[model samples]
Target: MNIPITNSIRHGRRYRQQGMVSTLIALIVLVVSLLAAMALMRSVDTSNTIAGSLTFRQSVLQEAERAYVDAQQKITFTQPTSDADNAPLGYYAEPQPATARSAGDVPNVLVNAVSGSIGSVTPLNSTDNSVTYVVERLCPTSGAATVTACIVPGASLLGATSSNQTSDNLTPFDNGAYAAFRLTVRVNGPKGTTAYVQTILR
Candidate 1:
């Protein structure tokens, strides 16, 4: 009878040991699941931040177009003459520095143009984004746009004297018939987002 009692006690001890091991495994699984959940949440937050940034950038780009249109209207209605430096109207008969069109941080020329009495400011959207633009004729000096002084699109590559009459039967593309103008639009948005859009027009 004593042997049977001892054997029953050993069986009880073995069952308790198995139960403890099972509990430990469950606790480890729970910890691992919690860590995974935390990682997933972080990933989702990162994705949301990236998406929001992209959307904001796109909106800023669209706002730039509005400024561009305003510049166009100014050019059409005001009709800049051969005179240079129409600062009040944001029209310059002379070309801008290369730094204005460079990539990376905002150019000093644009900052000065916007801050000073040059370029007109127009509100972009309800978010308080504003735009300013400067139009620069691609010419070294003021007065009339000459072939040697200005950048003319579709100008004869062979030479200024070369005529296209034989090939296309059309009159020779005049090298200095029209001048090319560069439109630089700067946008200032919320959270200190600054963007520049530039285009050449003839």
Candidate 2:
């Protein structure tokens, strides 16, 4: 005896196989899409963090520069160089020699001024930036005693020509003697950024 399979049964078996394959493809696509979305979000977050840091650094630098200028404006040559007793509230007559650091280096002060006004301490801004400054007269000694000791031109000084050429001429800088002072500013921004600025005014 021999038996033959029916066409309808064969067709139904084929349709079931096709449906299973379609379901598997959909699941795979969903997983890939989820992973891509997550990576994209992380990239965006990283970019935002870097941008915010740069903004903070810029803000702090600007605040520090302002303090440096302010310190110069508030103090004059007549002011004392050292106010050891009052310190921060008063301008230093002679620079604390320990803090007499070279240009671009932090001043070697016993007490670093953060804020408030005694001498050169800058007031805090309405914004988050906090500013402070120190003014140091460029002389080895403090008070009027060192007045002549300061850099004063006698009769000869190498003068600058319009061409800006240097000469060994021994005329003693004829220009009027000018005493210079240093202004150092420290700025603290809202985002934990710090900046230092210094200028020498004659």
Candidate 3:
């Protein structure tokens, strides 16, 4: 009878040891699974952030391009009108009432032009990304040009007389026009990222 009782006690002890080992293994697995889940979450978050930033950058660049195109069209349609009191021959004239040919009722157009000139540094979106742009016109001149100049010696013609003429130090447009205008756009992205784009408008 005593031997049987000792055998039973030994069996109970063995079962408890096995149970403890199983519990330890389960706890270790749970810990490893939690760690993997955390890492995956972090990776997903990082990817999302990158995608959002790229999208914002593209949007800002597109907006800048639209502004540039609108300015070009305005200049083209207005037919190079001189500023009030002939201040200077700027690419963009002052804001005027909407016409049928114009982009009509687009307040953002004026806002973009003003912001670009004044370095207003307005954001592309409400999420802290921003862009600033500048518009400049290159007119043929004889001397002392402000932004860019194309001057021909001994010729009274402006932007003409290519022979012996001083062309703009800047690269001319692909169309080979003696005079062309330019727009410079600078984009600032979140987390200190930035990019620059320049386009020529004739």
TM-score of each: 0.65, 0.51, 0.48
Off by over 4 Å in 3: 1-5, 70-130, 136-182, 188-195
RMSD (CA, Å), each prediction = 6.0, 8.4, 11.7
Off by over 4 Å in 1: 1-31, 76-82, 98-107, 112-114, 154-176
Candidate 3 structure, TM-score to reference: 0.48
Superior by TM-score: candidate 1 or candidate 3: 1
How do the residues 42-153 of candidate 1 rate in per-residue lDDT, one tens digit apiece? 9999999899788877876777677677776665422235345776777777765546335423335676654553576567457687677777765667766555555654
Output the better candidate (2/3) by TM-score: 2
User: Which has the greatest TM-score?
Assistant: 1
For candidate 2, lDDT tens digit of each residue in 117-182? 334434455666766666665555664423344432231222311112223431112232234455
Name every residue pair that clashes in candidate 1: none
Once model 2 is optimally superposed onto the true structure by TM-score, how far is the C-alpha of residue 15 displaced, in angstroms? 15
Among residues 3 or more apart in sequence or in different chains, the pairs in candidate 3 whose N, CA or C atoms overlap within 3 Å are none
lDDT of 3: 0.48
Q: Write the per-residue lDDT of candidate 3 for residues 1-202, one digit (tens) a residue.
A: 4355888899999999999999999999999999999999999999998997778667667767755655444443222232121112123323222213232222233234453333334344565656554444334332222222332233333333333323555333333333434455556666776555655543
lDDT of each: 0.64, 0.54, 0.48
